[model samples]
Target: MAYRLLALDIDDTLLKSNHRLTKETKEAVEYVKNKGVYITLATGRSFISARKVAKSLKLSDPYLITHNGSFLASHVKEPVFERRIGAETVYQVVDILENYHCHFKLFHEKYVIANKTRQKAQLISRVNLQLTDPLFYPVHYVESPSHRLIDQPLSVLNIRAEFWNKRERRDALEELEESVTGIRITPGGKEELFINHESASKALALQNLASRLGIAPYEIVAVGADMRDRDMVSQAGLGVAMGDAPEEVKASADWITRSNDQSGVAYMVKEVFRKQLRIETPHQ
Candidate 1:
């Protein structure tokens, strides 16, 4: 069966290591888009970060699943669906992170609030120079407890404790998992953790899109890099893992493609829309 929709993961899957779309990828997406296949992005980033990539590709305002599926938008600045952590749960998680001295960033719809000094914020900015447009807004510095202005609906609660050892980080996560209810906790990176509402997973968001488009869950193609991508990858008819993805993530995929820098998105488009893959392959 042909895939009616293509759901792509943004970071480390569609975009190169430099966080930019390659020319080959761009041309391939354009080619397939011309053939009338639906293309959308499912990412761990916020709408702000995801839109930049969408704009670069010149997609016809593709559906956006952002904040690891906590928010879905039809186009930039137009929200279609949103899920948020409970206020009580948010306070509980924040308290736990504070006790463990874990650094974190609270993600609302409009901005990201972090409790760190200007110098530390600048350091983080330097590390993530690709996000030069101020992805994070630092507030007054704090040690044990950190609080910031929460203006809009809270979607994702991101905790970055890379400074701590693996054992310590895991221990803190375990504690949080035990304490928090109605929240989904996933490994964001080697040292970071993401806490969101239980319903705010890529699988749910994909299902929502499928329902809206009158498509089945198995009629879509999903791809990603990190373990956070496991749910959607397993649910898609065609699940692709980036070359640099973890062993678990790779195992969950129907196919493994080259790294993002090698234009893997372009490769998939050609294989699917161009009908280059054999009948036994996932795209078929």
Candidate 2:
């Protein structure tokens, strides 16, 4: 089958373990783009953080699926589609999180507002000096995020929290799940959790974008390596899982490629996409 759109998850599915895009991977993405396959990044990262990767790919006017598909937009200021957490829910989440020993960050389209925690919860660097864009997801540290939210409510795209202790993280997740009404919490990393609106998911956003592009579920390829990516991976026509992905994630995939460290994305593009395209294309 010839796929029309290719949706890739940025963190583990696309980038390496060190968080760098390799030349081979870039070329592979270019290969698919040259073949006229629509490529999009469906990531849990904010638009700005994902934009850094998108810009490198030279994707002209890419419709990015960011914040675990909570926000879908081509430009930073304007969004094609979005599902932000309500101000009341955001306030409740913040108030509940403040009781835990975790560093939570509020995600917006342009900013990553974080809490000033003792454990140094700042995950991203100030800026990539190599890039000219000064505000590449500029992070702002607030003393009390709950206070700020109470004063000026923000319709946050998602909330990411990293815990000092795994047990605390588990407890916090349990509490939040129990307390929150309209939020979906999923494990993002080792000690991290991402909270988004109940209705927001990579699959939901991907389906929405696919409909807009006139692509059917059977004409799409989705790749990811996390629990958050389960639906998208399973529902897509060709669901690919990284070699290092969890068993459950792997079980849902139609194909499993090498690990991210081995440039799994590049491998998949060549072995799966390229090979399939060759079989479908007639000789000149």
Per lDDT, the best of the predicted structures is: 2
Candidate 1 lDDT over residue span 62-107, tens digit each: 6788888888887545777778886666767777776653456666
TM-score of 2: 0.92
Clashing pairs in 1: none
Q: Estimate each model's TM-score.
A: 0.85, 0.92
- Looking at model 2, residue 31 earns an lDDT score of 90
lDDT (Cα, tens digit) per residue for candidate 2, span 58-167: 88778889998899888888888899999999989889888888777788777767788656424433112212243555777899998998788898999888777789
Query: Candidate 2: which pairs clash?
Result: none
> What do the candidate models score in CA lDDT, each in turn?
0.71, 0.83
Q: How displaced is residue 94 in candidate 1, in Å? A: 1.3
RMSD per candidate (Å) reads: 4.6, 3.7
Total clashing residue pairs per candidate? 0, 0
